[model samples]
Target: MEEKYFEISTENLKKFIDGIITDNYEVIAPTDKDGDTFYGKINKFEETNLDILLPKMSYKEYLLPKTETLFEYSISGVDTEVKDGLQNIAGANEKRVIFGGRPCDAGAGPIMEKVFNWDYKDEFFNERFKNLTIISIACEKPDNYCFCTEMQLSPESSYGSDILLKKSGDKYFAIVTGEKGLNLVKAYSNLFTETAKDKVPADKDWKKIFEVEKTKSFLDKNFEHNYFQERFLSCIGCGVCTYTCPTCHCFDIQDEGNLKEGRRIRNWDSCQFGIFTLHTSGHNPRVTQGDRYRQRLMHKFKIYSEKFDKYLCVGCGRCSRNCPEDIDIKEVAKNLAEMA
Candidate 1:
């Protein structure tokens, strides 16, 4: 379908969201939690906190949960019985709408989707993704940590978003970019208008801080460079970077139960962990923090790009913002570009 545009007043936008909630759609939005803003389920539009450019964490958990059960099994004498966990998962068949996410967060969806469907189709990830609708708000005031423009994406890119919204005075210029967005507008036709308002133009002043292609070239040949060892000396192997990253998809699966019964579960894992690559024979591939950090960079810039023809990062800067060592990925990429 061709793209369609419309304008909606702020009042009607609130009503639209409240109506979605009233209709029993699982609404996920940036809401105030503890003292900071995070993506979480909201009961109404009033609970959303859209004052910030990006939330503390992306809405990835709604699609790929932090911990999920693959299946449950029970042992009876010599026979084993299994049960599909998807049948028991809550909200498995409900539609989910993610509103007020930034473009960087929205873009992570397609990047992750590629990985889930590469070698084998991940039904667990696909089911949630298929039911999700992204309504991202364009960035009006990006902070210093933002580098979406450098990653070949803009604040208003609308790459993975169903509907991209840009606030203009008392209304929003909404661009319906996909089938889901068109269906949403058709379902709520009264909330949107065919006003002749001009769509918000992309920011011309948003500069690209580094050339990603050049950085990739440098990483392609300099896998064992001394820069990795010296630059990552401060890394403490905390795995915080991978946990907060929008595009990191590494996970670990475990079976927990006694001889009677048990369930196979998948949990989020990180390459930064010291034992991530440890072998039962007491051998470790990535022994130092530098080696693990280098793996992280290589996976994001070179490995994934070589396979998917796209970078595995959306440049959301959550790692740098939440890192205890204050490591900045943008600076690292710029330094690699300089080296190239």
Candidate 2:
């Protein structure tokens, strides 16, 4: 497909965003909340905050909520009935824009879509994904833990982004990638002007080198390797990495309420906990922190990729940033690659 480029100054960008608000579409962007940045709902032009680094959490929560009700059931004596639990959001059917998303955050949605659509389709997730438009802001100042380049993705990667915006002087160089993006551009054509693509300097420093293939190969042959036991000695099993990850999608189904009335809920779960794999017989296969940690790495680099032709991780670095023990994934991958 031919790439289309447009230029929009700061003023025009604000106008375009305001137009979205006027049209009754929700705009979610990075915002400062309690001195930390997070993807939040924006009502005005001034609400969007892009000066900070990446948000603490990825935008996954917007699509697959942290907690969702699957269905509701009620019973009185001998009568029992089940009912749908989905409640429509206000203007949910309208297009929602994820403005100013980073490349890694924007790219993770499509990677996760694979599993949700596999075997059985998750209707709840699909509905939100179908109605959403992703607008990515290319990274200019990646931090120390960022290793997207090592995972074969760059700041400019546009795998799941409908539109990509790169800052060029006082204006932005924008590229519309899909039908939704094209429609948005055409609707706001007056705000955009044709321009050349911005030139990225070669001296821009990113993170460490990685051998993704080597890491996968090592895991394939060393399924019983001692490094899994030795490397996770300091792990506290807090599950912070999995919770903050852009790609981890494990969940637990729970029934809430009394015996007379109840709602089945799907809440996010993590493999880091022993109860995550505990059976009714009280036998837990992944009993140790090392075993759980190994499963995390295996699913991310080896198993998921082998099944879906894509790595489960997007190299966003959120896991390393939020890990209490400072266990960096890039460091683990580098050590595995160099191992005998």
Candidate 3:
């Protein structure tokens, strides 16, 4: 709290995490079980993993939640009735500390805040965000399609992160961005020292490998372009990219089970699928795979920028990582720019 930046020894990083866990803080980080990424309350700091390279999915799964029950309903006779059962987040009373979130993953939180709170104030999202404190880990290298710079976002982006952490040498350099971040550091002041000059990322420009401007230009010029027959021709229409994208915030609301007893639930959805924009009247808005594919790029570059004045794509390249169809976003962006 003395200065904005503080340093803790690499040796103490795990210990500090353990201490947070001891304080009843739900410490969530990347963990592997059968080579699958799972985030849960870590019982020990040793459970914190930063060596997974790139997680196929973003950390938004924890904050936004994959499924949420709006309420429960039951019918008596002719009148259908519903009762509120869920949608409660004990923010003030609950505390969360999320660690090892990449800049792209962490930055999506603030961007999502606008839409979730725009038309109607979503108390559920706001509560989760308020109670949650993020500690973003700076990325060391750029993935194939990642152009964080295109959106003026970087591996060092401090958007939703309460505490920013950079791995420098054997130590981790940290900075507190909000009151919660400060309190967190203060809670474990003994484990940390005053801001150390030696704890800065040696190669701060490590992300220069990805061409941000080139990617943006490609996206801008390809507004009227359809990537379907070209780059996405081999795409199996799998919604893997949407699931991997940090900024892809689409969900489906469904009422399942019998009409007498039902519940409204929200589940993660993808624009890549034909059913995404399907209307109840049976007229599918985005019927073609090409249209769905183009929507993905358009939403990231134009629509999101128009709405939030910020590009939605974080350039994490998770889409490339998870694409079973071998769709490469970097090549697609570059090809768009080159062809134009």
Candidate 4:
């Protein structure tokens, strides 16, 4: 279907969201919590905090949970029985609407989706991704940490969003980019005006800080470069960077329970951890923090791109903004570009 444009007043937009909630769709939006903004479930439109550029964490958790059960097994004497864990997930089939995320946050869904569907289909992630609708608002005032433009994504880009909303005075110029968005507009026809808003408001002037191609080239040639070792000296290997990153998808599987019964679960894991590559024989491949950090950069800039043809990063700046050591990824990329 061809893309369509419509203008919706702020009043009507609120009503539309409220209508979605009334229709039994779970609405997730940025909400204030302890003076920090985080994505959480909202019952009404009034709970959404759209003023923030981005949330502390992306809405990825809603799709790929921090910890998910994969399967369950029980042992009876010498016989064993296994059961699928999909039925154990609460709200696995619920329809969800992710509203007011930034373009970077929305762009991360597709990037992660590629990995989930790479070799083996991840039914756990696919179930949530299929039921979710992303409605991202374009950024008008980005701060120093934002670098979405460097990753080939602009504030107004609708790459992963079903609907992209740009603020224009008291109304929003909405661009429906896919079938989901078209169906949404059709359902809420009373809220959206027929009068088309042809022109979307201009995006903020977010300058490209570094050339990603040059950074990729640098990584491709210099895997053993001392830059990675010397630069991340302050990195305490706390795994906070991976936790806050929108595109980090590494995980570890563990079995829990006694001999009678147990469940296999997938838990979020980080390469930044020291024990991540620790073998059972006690010889770890990535011995130092620098080695672990280099793996992270290589995976994001070089390895994943070579396989998927898309960088495993959206330049949301959450990893840098939330870093206790204040180590910035944008700066690292810029430095690599200059070296190249």
The best candidate by TM-score is: 1
Q: Per-residue alpha-carbon lDDT of model 1 for 201-298, expressed as tens digits?
A: 44457778889998899999998999999999999999999998999989999989999999999999999999999999999999999999999999
Q: Lowest summed-lDDT stretch of 10 residues in model 1?
A: 195-204
**What tens-digit string does per-residue lDDT give for candidate 3 at 197-282?**
44555536544444444555666766556555455667677899988787788988888869678888889998888777889999
Error of 2 at 232 (Å): 0.9
**Which candidate's lDDT is highest?**
1
lDDT of 2 by residue, 26-141 (tens): 89999889989899999987998988668899889988889988888899899999877555543474679999889898878988899999999988888888889999988888
Give the Cα lDDT of each candidate.
Answer: 0.90, 0.86, 0.75, 0.89
- Top-down TM-score ranking: 1, 4, 2, 3
Candidate 1 achieves a global lDDT of: 0.90
| Every model's TM-score | 0.96, 0.93, 0.88, 0.95
Model 4 poorest ten-residue lDDT run: 194-203
* Residue range with the least summed lDDT across 10 consecutive positions in model 3: 84-93
- Candidate 2 deviates by what RMSD? 2.4
Compared with the true structure, the alpha-carbon lDDT of candidate 4 equals 0.89
Instruction: Please give the TM-score that candidate 1 achieves against the real structure.
Output: 0.96
Candidate 1 collision pairs: none
Error of 2 at 104 (Å): 0.3
Candidate 4, 252: how far from true, in Å?
0.2
**Span of 10 residues, lowest total lDDT, candidate 2:** 197-206
> Which sections of candidate 3 miss by over 4 Å?
1-3, 74-82, 85-87, 196-203, 206-227, 257-260, 280-282
Candidate 4 structure quality by residue, lDDT tens digits, 1-340: 6668889999999999999999988899999999999999999999999888888988889878899889999999999999888876545646689999989999999999999999999888988898888898988877788888998898788889999998889999888888998889899998886545446655667679789999999998998899988998889999999999999999999989999999999999999999999999999999888899899989988899999998998989999999999999989988998998
Pairs that collide in candidate 3 are 146-315
lDDT-best of 2 and 3: 2
